[model samples]
Target: MKVLLHVSHLVQWDIALSNSKNLKAIEAKSKIEIVVNAHAIQLYRELSENLLQQLNELENLNIKVKLCRNALRNNNIEESTLPATVEIVPAGIFEIIKKQEEGYYYVSP
Candidate 1:
């Protein structure tokens, strides 16, 4: 299964991450991508050690962490400052739609 997890609000970070983790645990063969956009983009720049560790854990589980380039630009966050594990997409909405077209299940948590 392919899953697209969306995080648009800052408060959704923990819920999104937890949802991703739970999905992986429930199905080991699932392909999961967590796409962070909008105000949630600040989570990347304002990462606490715990948050960073959780993101790293997801990477270790082979989950893709995607950041929206437009959001980053709007928030004034430098790509160089983001964690190396993340992949930046041109737009979050575009990415989500593309993934859905490709048969990934979309979830906003």
Candidate 2:
């Protein structure tokens, strides 16, 4: 099964990650997508190395991490500043909608 985790709020970062981890742990073949947008993009950038390591661990576990281009523009953040693991999409909401149409279950914290 696949899930699209829509994360728009900075406060939900930890909850989203933890739930993704739990899902990945319980379902070995589960597909996880983490979409970070809005204030969460800045939150992602401001994260410490340790938290980033946790994110890396999720990537290692095959979770796809996405960032929104519009969110970056809104926050005045450069696209080049994002991590190597994150793929920049045109917009977070659009991506989420596409994923939903593609049969990916949506989860939000």
Candidate 3:
């Protein structure tokens, strides 16, 4: 199973991360990708220790992290400051649509 998690607001990070963790725990074979856009892009920079640990856990689980290039520019977040595992996409909405077309279950948390 492929899951695409869409996180647009800063406040949704916790729930999104929690859901990703739960999904992996429930099915280790599940493919998970977390996409960040809008205000959520800010969280990708200068992450708190707690959030950094959570992201490391996601990496350990083999989950992919993607950030929107548009969002990064709009939020003034540098790509270099993000986690090495994160992929920067051209656009978040387009990426989400493409993932769905490829049969990835979309979850907005």
Candidate 4:
């Protein structure tokens, strides 16, 4: 199973973290992708050091993280400035659509 997590607000960080726990607990083969856009881009900036470390660890667990280029542009952040774990996509909405079409289950978490 594949899951696409849509993150667009700061409040969703908790949702994402909880979802990560659930996903990791599963025994079945599954893929988790977390996409960040809009105000959620700042979510990373606000993360506590421990949480940030945990987020980086998600990559090791095979949970992918993505950030929208347009969102970064709006915030005046350079794509190159993002952490190595997060992928920079052209657009968040488009990426969501593409993932959906590819059979990923979409979740706001």
Candidate 5:
């Protein structure tokens, strides 16, 4: 199954990443995609090196983390700050709707 995780709340990236880990544990073979919008990117940028390392592990698990272009612009975050695999989608909400419409389960955390 395809799962779309919408992360909009502000907090440590570890929490979001941890949730992703838990989800993966529950559904070992599920295809998980994450959308980090608004303040979430800001939190990720501020994470400590160790936390960032944990986030890097997500890539090994094949979980794609996307940042909202609108949110990046609104927060004045440079593209260079993001990880290489972090995709920039046009609109996070639209992506969520589109994925849900296409049969991906929507989860917010």
Candidate 6:
């Protein structure tokens, strides 16, 4: 099973990270893809040094973190500030819809 995580809130990173850490707990799990937007982007960017290290570890675990291009533009966040692994999606909501249409389980955290 593929999971599409929609991260719209900053504090939800705790849940997202916890879920990522326990991926095997999911009833039917194969691949996990995380799509982040809104304030989550800023939180990821402003993570503490230790938290950043944890995020890097998560990245190595094959979690794909995506940022919404529209949100970045609206918030005046420069793309360069984001980690290189973070992809810019055209629209966060649209991305969620597309992922669901493609059979990914959508979760908001």
Which candidate number would show the highest lDDT if scored against the true structure? 1
lDDT of each: 0.90, 0.86, 0.89, 0.83, 0.80, 0.78
Please state the error at residue 109 of candidate 6 in Å: 2.3
Estimate the TM-score for candidate 2: 0.92
Q: Which should have the higher TM-score, number 2 or number 4?
A: 2
Q: Which ten residues in a row have the lowest lDDT in candidate 3?
A: 44-53
lDDT of 2 by residue, 26-104 (tens): 9989988989998888875565787679778888989988999988898888777667877889989999999999999
lDDT of candidate 4 over 1-109, digit per residue (tens): 8999999997996788678768878843688888899998876554468766866778777888888888888887866655777788999999999999999999996
- What order do you get sorting by lDDT, best first? 1, 3, 2, 4, 5, 6
List all candidate RMSDs to the true structure: 1.0, 1.3, 1.2, 1.7, 2.0, 2.2
Residue-level lDDT of model 5, residues 1-109, one tens digit each, is: 8888888877635566877788889888988888888777676555568656765788888898888888988888887777676788998888889889989988776
Query: Could you tell me which 10 consecutive residues in candidate 4 have the lowest summed lDDT?
Result: 43-52
All candidates' TM-scores? Answer: 0.94, 0.92, 0.92, 0.89, 0.85, 0.84
Q: Each model's number of backbone clashes?
A: 0, 0, 0, 0, 0, 0
* Cα TM-score of candidate 3: 0.92
lDDT of 1 by residue, 39-78 (tens): 9998877768997898789889999989999999999999
In model 1, the runs with Cα more than 4 Å from the true position are: none
Q: How do the residues 21-66 of candidate 3 rate in per-residue lDDT, one tens digit apiece?
A: 8888899899989898999888876768887788788899998888
Instruction: Please give the lDDT score at residue 30 for candidate 6.
Output: 62
Candidate 4 wrongly placed segments (more than 4 Å): 45-48
Which residue pairs does candidate 1 place in steric collision? none
- TM-score-superior candidate, 4 or 6: 4
Q: Which candidate has the highest TM-score of all?
A: 1
Error of 2 at 17 (Å): 0.9
Error of 2 at 60 (Å): 0.6
